[model samples]
Target: MLKIDSIKFDDEKMDNDRLNNYIKKSEDAVEIFVDLLKMDGQEEVVGMIALDNDHRLIGVLELMRGGDTFQKIGTDDLFYLALRLDADSIILAQSKADGLKVSKEDYQFNEFLIEEADKFRINIHDNLIISGRDYISIS
Candidate 1:
């Protein structure tokens, strides 16, 4: 069984406030989702970017159709390799695509994510997009 797959925001150590400090309500950030596939035993992630109105970047979630769910991987897993620009809020959801729904409280970052899950699409960053990852400083 996969031991970790939560989405509550406070569950893990948030990088720091700087991640989202520059984000403006007047402008919305673009959220990107990456799906890495290993078809011939070689690794390659197929990434999709999600955008909000006003076009600032918001989320940068990763996906895999088989094997590991995003939550099963440690926080640094993707960061060490393929990282999105960065964000005030980066999250992992054990998507229903896998036939799972983690309890709200038991899930980390659940509220922010689930609330935005619907009414969004995968898109790319153009000049108008503001990346949260770009402004945040790590402690």
Candidate 2:
């Protein structure tokens, strides 16, 4: 049998200034991708930005990483994290090393996310496709 004890750390409240400043628009999301993701690589990646009810960012999660062309996002896993983080809404983003167009699959996935989020009462703010220095909002 394995027993696990809870670990604790000092709590500190931080201002939401940085997140509020950076995530104002779809283009800002592209800037976040450029800074956070290793876009020079050949692999495709899917990530989410969790936000509170006020649209202030809570955190960013990288959900899936796959080959240059394909990455599948698990809706259950995505929302599970959101609930764990106590997020009220989320922005979905994917990287395409080849181009900046939102694929049909991406659109379908966003629709699926919207449907599932409704069931959970979570908001799906936007879906973005990022490639190099550019991005497209498919919301």
Candidate 3:
């Protein structure tokens, strides 16, 4: 059996006030993700923003964490949470502890995510790579 863990959000640990201000823009998405992840000298982490039909914040999911080089996220694993939350759209994000440049792997991953998202009737609004004090949107 391929067991998927139950997704949970630690409300107390998240900056809900800052997150609520995000309005689906790439910049706002980056701000919210940076605040949530606080990727200061830390390893790479993958996260997702779940949104309702109106683009309101549903919640955030921290999907995977890996060393400096890479982090892996599976479409099936991500969509499981989206389905559970009944989300209409999702914004994907990953911390690039190295810098703000988008790697070939990043491009391929976002491409795969977009194709996979369509099958579930979910819109992938954007994919952001956050670095020190900057970000790049590969939507």
- Best candidate according to lDDT: 3
lDDT of model 1, residue 134? 26
Estimate candidate 1's alpha-carbon lDDT, on a 0 to 1 scale.
0.29
Residue 136: error of model 1 in Å? 27
Model 1, range 43-79, lDDT digits (tens) per residue?
A: 3222222224433334444345434333454434433
Kindly provide the TM-score of model 2 when superposed on the true structure, using C-alpha atoms. Answer: 0.76
Candidate 3 deviant stretches above 4 angstroms: 1-17, 68-71
True lDDT of residue 18, candidate 3: 48
When 2 and 3 are scored with lDDT, the better candidate is: 3
* Cα-based lDDT for every prediction: 0.29, 0.67, 0.71
Estimate the TM-score of every prediction. Answer: 0.28, 0.76, 0.78
Regions more than 4 Å wrong, model 2 = 1-22, 68-71
RMSD of each: 15.9, 6.4, 6.1
Scanning candidate 1 in windows of ten residues, the lowest lDDT window is 130-139
The true-versus-predicted C-alpha distance at residue 98 of model 1, in Å, is: 5.4
User: What are the clash counts of all predictions, listed in order?
Assistant: 22, 0, 0
For residue 137, give model 1's deviation from the true position in Å.
26
- Residue-wise C-alpha lDDT for candidate 2, range 18-128, written one tens digit per residue: 233325577666665556654433568777777788766667777777764334456787888888878898887778767776668878877877999998888988888
